[model samples]
Target: MGLFNRIKEPIFLKESSNAEIQIEKLKALKPLLNPEGQNIIEQDIKHLEYGIVGEKNIAFELKNSHMTMYILHDVYLEDGDISAQIDYLVFTKKICFVIECKNLYGDIEINSAGDFIRTTDFRGRKKKEGIYSPLTQNQRHLELMKKLKVDNKNNILTKFVVGKYFEDNYKSVVVLANPKTILNAKFAKKEVKEKVIRADQLVKYIKNMYEQSKEIGVSDERLLEWAQSFLELQKEMLKDYTDKYEQYKIYKDKAVKSIQKIIPTVEDKKATTIIVKLPVEETEIFKELKAYRLNKSREENIKPYFIYNDKQLKDLISKMPRNNDELQAVAGFGELKINKYGNDILKIMSKY
Candidate 1:
C-alpha cells in the first residue's frame, strides 16, 4: 500500500501566480482549518516557495520580451492516480518549453550518466553534495503531457482550453534560476546543452527557440487565450516534496515503457516511416551519428568504436534508446560507455 490514504475528497493544494499573496492567504486561513489541512497547506507553501521564486525569475526575464509566447506557472494537474506538477510551461506555436526550476545557489555539475553534484559556497567554505537528476523528473512531466494528448498527437490540451485545437511539441529543460550558481554540464554533447541552462541564459535560450520556430506561427492574442484557458483548467494536485515522497515515488507506466521512453522528434518519426534498404550503418542518420562519434572519440584519444562501432551505432539507430537502461539493452553498450556517452547518443537519436 502507498503512504497516502484516501478520504471522500483529496484537498489538492492550491497553485498561485503570486507566491507572496498565496503565502499570506494560507497563513490567514491556517487558524480556521483542521490540523491536517493546515499541515498540508504549510508543507505546500514551504516547498513551493523556492520553486515559485525560480519560476518568477524566468518570468521576469520573459516579461520584458515582445516574443509571442504564453507563460504558465504552477500547473498542477491530476488524472486518476497520476499527477503532473509543472513549474513553468512556456508555449509558442512551434514549441513548448517544459521547464523544471532548480533554485540552488552553488556550483553544479552533472555527468553524462545524469549524476548531479553541487557545491555551495557558504561563508567561504564550500559544501558539496549529490542530488537526484531533475532531468529525469522533467521527463515524467513530458510523458504526462503526451498521455493527456497535450503533446505529440492530439491537440486538446485541456478541457477548458477551448477551440480544442492547439498543439506543439515538448522540449524538457532544467533551469538553474540562480545566476550566482555556476553550472558545468559541458561534458554533454551539442544537443544536450539546450536541456539544461542557468538563469541568465534562460531568456537567450528562449529567444533561440523562438528564432528556430518562427516558421510555425501563432498570433499573440490566441496564445494568451490558450494560456488563460490553461490557467483555468489547472486542477490542483500533489506538487510538493512531502506529497511526492508519500505517493507516486516512482513514475508508473503500465504498458510497453520502452516505446513510451522514446522522445522522437517530428523529423525522426518521419524518417522512421520511410523504408530504406541500406544497411543500418549506411543509412544517412546512422552515418551522421557515426561521424559525430568519431569526432568525439578522436578528441578523447580513444578508438571511435569505443564510443560505438558501425554495428553498435546501427543498433542504436534501430532501437532508439531513450534512457540509460534502454541504451544498455542495445548490443555493445556496456556499463562504462552507457555512463560516459549514453545521454549524448540518446539525445542524438531522439532528434533523428
Candidate 2:
C-alpha cells in the first residue's frame, strides 16, 4: 500500500501499536492496586478511553479525504522535554491540517483570550468548569512542526519562496467531538470560529480547504516523501514516550529557539561566517519574516506585505537590527513598528 493507501476501514487508534501498549500497562496495573488506587487508575483509564473514542470518531468522519490526503491518528511527538499528542493530523504535500479533538460535552464559551468555559447538566444540578484551551494546545503542535526543517532554509531562501507553506500550516482546527455540545463564544475572534468547528462541519471544511489547497504545486512523490518524514518522526516519538516510564514532561516555560547549526565556509585558511538576520524577508530572513507577515495579515484581514515591501525587506535584513534603537535604522520600521515588533524581532534574531 502507498503511504496513504486506504484499507477497507480506517486506521485509527483501534489499530495503533501504542493503543496496545497502553492497554498492556492497564492490565499490568490491575493486580497490584488497592481499592483506592484502583479507583484513581480507573479514572485515568476512563479519560484515556474517552480520548480514543474522540480520535476514532474524528478518524471515521475523515474517510472522505483518504483518497486525496494522508490521515494519521493518535500521533505522539516529543520535542525535547515536551510530549504533544495529536488526535488527528490530516495533510497533503503542500498543506498540513491539525485537528485537536475535544471529547467534551455541554455549552462551550470561549473568551477572547482563548480560555474555555464549559457549562452543562449533571442530573439537572447544572455544573460548570473551565477546560484548557484547545486553540493553544493545537498551536503548540503547529509551532513545533514549523520549527522542523530539513535545513534552515531561512538562511538562504525568500519568505514567499520557502514560507508560503508555513503561513498555511498555522491554520489549524479544534473539533468538539460531541454533537450535543453548543458553542457560545459570542466574543470569540473571527479567526477562532474559522478554526474551531463542530464535528458535522469538519468534512465540508476539509473538502473546501483541500480545494483551496490544490495549487500547492508540489509533486505526489515529493509531497508523499515530506509526509512520510513526519510520520517517521512520530514513530520515533511513540517509543520515546512509552519508554519514558518516568512520565511525560509538561512544558511550563516556553523554550526559545536554539541555534542548532551555524553556517560558515572556509577561505584562505580562515572561517568566514555568514551572519543571518531572521526578521527580514527577500533576504535570508525572508521566510520567517514573510510567514510572520502572512499570519499578521490574516489576523487583521490586510494584505500580507502591507507592513513592508520587497526593498524594505531586503534593507531590513541588511540592517540586521539587534535592538529597538537599531530597528529604527531599518527602512519602514518607524516608531510604531519599533514599539510593536522590536522585542519579537530581537528574540527571533537571537535564535539564529
Candidate that would win on TM-score: 2
Give stretches of model 2 more than 4 Å off: 1-20, 150-155, 158-165, 213-217, 235-352
- The clash count of every prediction, one per candidate, is 0, 2
Model 2 residue 43 distance off true place after TM-score fit, in angstroms: 0.8
The per-residue C-alpha lDDT of model 1 at residue 220 equals: 49
* Model 1, runs deviating above 4 Å: 1-15, 18-48, 122-125, 150-168, 219-229, 237-352
Model 1, position 39: C-alpha lDDT score: 73
Tell me which residue pairs clash in candidate 1.
none
Q: What does candidate 1's lDDT look like per residue over 75-111, in tens digits?
A: 8644434557788887665667788888886788876
Backbone steric clashes in candidate 2, count: 2
- RMSD of each candidate relative to the true structure: 22.1, 17.8
